[model samples]
Target chain A: MNKTVLQIIRFVVLVLFQVLVINHIRLGGYVHPYIYMLFIMLLPFNTPKWQLLVLGFALGLTVDLFTGTPGLHAGATTLMAFCRPSIIQLISGNQKFENIPEPNLGQLDGMWFFRYVLCLVFVHHFALFFLESFSFRLIGQVLLRILLSVPVSVFLIMMILYIFKRERKRE
Target chain B: MYNLQRFILKHHFVILFILLEVISILLLARSQNFHRNSLVNTSNVVVGKIYEWSSDVGNYFRLNTANEQLAEENAMLRQQLSIVYDTASCVYDVNEGDTLYEYIPAKVVNNSTNQANNYIIINKGARDGIERDMSVISTDGIVGVVTDVSRHYASIMSLLHSKSVVGVRFKNNQEIASVKWQTNNYRYGIVEDIPTHIVLQQGDTILTSSHSKIFPEDLMVGTVEEFYPTAVDALNKAKIRYATDFSTLRHVYVIKDLHKAETDSLKAKFQ
Candidate 1:
């Protein structure tokens, strides 16, 4: 499959999995896994900066529409997309992450990929949670939600990254 | 001019990003673009379909829990129905001339207690003799006021939700206040802006005042859970434990007075 078709398929499967499956897996309280971020993280490195932003916004807005949080998810995901290039460079300046098939644990390995994803995921989720809670004051409750959500989101991200790692090993 | 055009074309990706960001920022800042309602956007259709499918899937999983709850409620309702004729409506015990208090039943088809600006949807609508501004209550206490009515469904401003401001009095005392939720904590909220002259205690019971045309004279809200008298301002704040367990609430009554529309119209004219 070509890049666009593969990307589209990946997006559909991941988002469907998130809304249909992952969102339902709410662990007790506020710790809901956000496997949806895979859409943004999976965008090919060589994708144009503007295209990346738009795609990110589209993916986020989609999530927001489903979740009933208008503009919040879009805003958070767009921020991640905007900073994707910087994150790649920060992770490895010489390696040129663009030529790679997609983001994977094996490709950006030895905790480089983990930390890279960790930072971006936190940024995305922090923006989302904060924006939704904007009208209300940030009590300990708000902090608690963020702390709870991070681990779930990280686990999902790692799982998706592992899939990419598997695909890369085949090549 | 050619060199400038080439430069612009070379940096077009950056320009596009800037433009897109500006659009998103604009939507965020101005809430009502009317035509730009996110619910009607391209993303919405896809997301809506996915969410509907997800809700269907999720509801299946939650059905077991929901079944247990329904069974418990059925027993409670059956018990209440059995004793409907025998029990006294008023707790304080009325004197000589007291009219029979009537309750208008309503079923909540739609409920949103988790959201900030939440509303409850009742199956009763215009056809069911429902109208806007009617007070909704459960046997436990006040639920909300009917805000909108259609042919089949009426929407209510849920008491647990934010933006619910009902006029209330404290323990048959001098001060009248508005009861509103601080957040999603439906069990508790503050009776804000109560006057200083009203002496308060920890155990003092707060009730819905009759001043608001919605509810009648005195209905139980909850006991004063906590209080902080104003250090600077005259009005004090006190947290109230709401009577109804909102999470477990099932049935409710829509309080409709015959004179509600007239009174509502008169109030609107003055405003």
Candidate 2:
């Protein structure tokens, strides 16, 4: 019950933050960070596949609702959710998920967990910026948006995870 | 039926994932339609209301700059007001076929300049008599055209968008050409189809051509930053330094061309 409530709260807060605050940010005309994908990244290891896909779609659609870009976010987040299991197995050497109720820095090695988040974020952002551009003509600009946005978003997600996860674990 | 049910149960997750993804791609393509189905777009009531609230707070911080811009425009208008109407100028001519245009003031509540297809959201919409294809302009120069509108909000396809095309000409010579964004820097646009024989010197003033009723004749567009002939056939192409700084745009005017219906109906007869 506590976990379900926390996830719901995170979803609401992240979506509001993304639309209200981060959407307004225009850092040097590039770094538009989207940290809302952190919700998908932190889901429990035993999460049902159908539920993961639905949650990812919901998150992306909520963002698309505000940004006015239809399907760009939804497509990218769904792709991330679809590929999450493969990425996890590659990172942890096919370790059984039963040992880990949730994929966190506490259970997974720090470097491995970092790599997992980095890869998923890259895939998510890659699909997003490319789908948004949808043309090879502006490949330079699209690559620039991805390169700049990914690092900023990753850093923010990691900071939030550390702070929030530690507090939750204490309780 | 039994076999199909077993297959569905086994691969339900994969099927759902693919289904959602396909739906998303379709939505993306639909949004790109030329008609721009506004119902599914950002101009919808719920999202539009949220943006309006956010812009209300954001517009406060920009009050000082907006005031300065309005003051500067007011001073310029005041100076023009003092000028006696010149009978010699065509603008003053009361010809039978003359078309009159009216302006509607609006605030730009949401805008993006970085995208390949940039769009602006204004505070006025259908209730304000804003119709599709009406030209939007800032105090300085051309801004964009209205693509879609709901009850109280409208979305403009900005001049910086890759697909935007505006008819323009040289202020000094009246030599006409069409300007289009080349999906590059927002500060510049390319003027295509100028004849090779014409010499376009740098820093020449460009203005909206009278060829189109969308914009009034001789409105400032931009100055020529560079000009050259295409390698293939000596076709003259000039790069224009756009007048409106879209990044800082706040307020604008939507023009209603009163004679549009008459002219359009007349032109349709030629087809």
Candidate 3:
């Protein structure tokens, strides 16, 4: 499939899944995993800086509209996108991206991919929860929420990516 | 001029990032103000319609629970009706003459309890006589207040939200306090401003106080789960278990105070 068309389909599917399914899963009221961050994470390596930021903002705004939070998700996701390129460079030190088309489990070493996902997911979740609380007064609760939610979100995103990669290999 | 253009072209990414962040911050600021009509809430027709469709499917899975709640409310209403009929005819006539509150039934199209700032979208909206600032309550207890309304839908600030507060009083002694959700727990809220003289007890019922302009007096709020004296303030604080199970909330009533305008105008004179 064409890469652009594939990414578009992934965008719609992930957004629908996040809003309709994941948003309803409130385990202990603390583990609200935002799996839609996968859409931003999985974008092509060569995607333009401008496109990355715009797409990130649009994706988050779509969720905010559905969830009735006007700008909380938008701000966090945009910040994640802004930091993506730098985080990628910082994680893949001394490694060249000449042969790699994008960051994925198949193309990157398992440890490297895990570290990358963890870093970006942490940034997203940290920004999201802190922005949602928007207060230093509730810093303890906010930190606890970030600590609990990030791992769940990272795990779910990686699981979905692994399943899709396997299906593509079989095809 | 060429040097300036080159600088702009070289650092466009940073400029764009800052621009988008600024827009997001503006939106965040706008939404934080309680009275402002935000541009990107679920009360918008498109978003509300989507949630309405999804909740339609979700409703089937919880039908049994919803039915039980309705049945329980019916029994309670019937009990109230019998008492009303048993009263003196003169007193009944006087009660009929003054109807201070009106209720508009609405279905929950979308709801969330886990977010720090949670909101509920309902099916009824401006067309159904739902307006901003009207109080919402479930069959069991108070829910929230309407904050935004479109033609076909309205968005409510749920009691689970960090900023949501309700004026409440103890049912046993009528001593007033305010309930606020300071923690992530949906079933519990923190009660503040309790008078130092009032004795505390677990399982005490809390009801909406007459001091509130939005909610009616004596509506069920919750029950005392625990109490403690805060180190900083002389007032005692307590934890209360909300009467309404927000996780399964489906149907609700939007209360319209008939004399709200009169009350506001009268209160404005003092200000």
Best by DockQ: 3
| Residue-by-residue lDDT tens digits, candidate 1, A24-58 | 45354446457787777767677778888889888
Q: In what order do the candidates fall by DockQ, top score first?
A: 3, 2, 1
TM-scores vs. true structure, each candidate:
0.69, 0.89, 0.95
lDDT of 2 by residue, B1-271 (tens): 9999999999998999989999999888887764576544543677777778888898899899989999999999977755634544556654555658889999987787656677888889899999988999999889988888888888888997867888888877778889999764678999888987778889999889988556777777888999887768757888889999887888999999888888899989998
Note the residue pairs that clash in candidate 1: none
| Candidate 2 local lDDT, residue B183 | 63
Model 2 pairs whose backbones collide: none
Best by lDDT: 3
For candidate 1, write residues B1-271 as lDDT tens digits: 9999998899876776676656655555453221224343344334434444544554577777666865786798889765753575454343544434545776554454444445565666788888777788876777888766666556676786545677888875747888888764657878878888776888887788878666766877777888888879888888888886666455678876755556679989989
* Model 3, runs deviating above 4 Å: B41-43, B94-97, B230-232
Question: Any runs in candidate 2 off by more than 4 Å, and if so which?
Answer: A27-32, A94-101, A105-109, A136-145, A162-165, B41-43, B84-99
Model 3: how large is the Cα RMSD against the reference?
A: 1.8
As a whole number from 0 to 100, the lDDT of residue A112 in candidate 1 is 77
- Evaluated with TM-score, which candidate comes out highest? 3
Candidate 3 shows a clash count of: 0
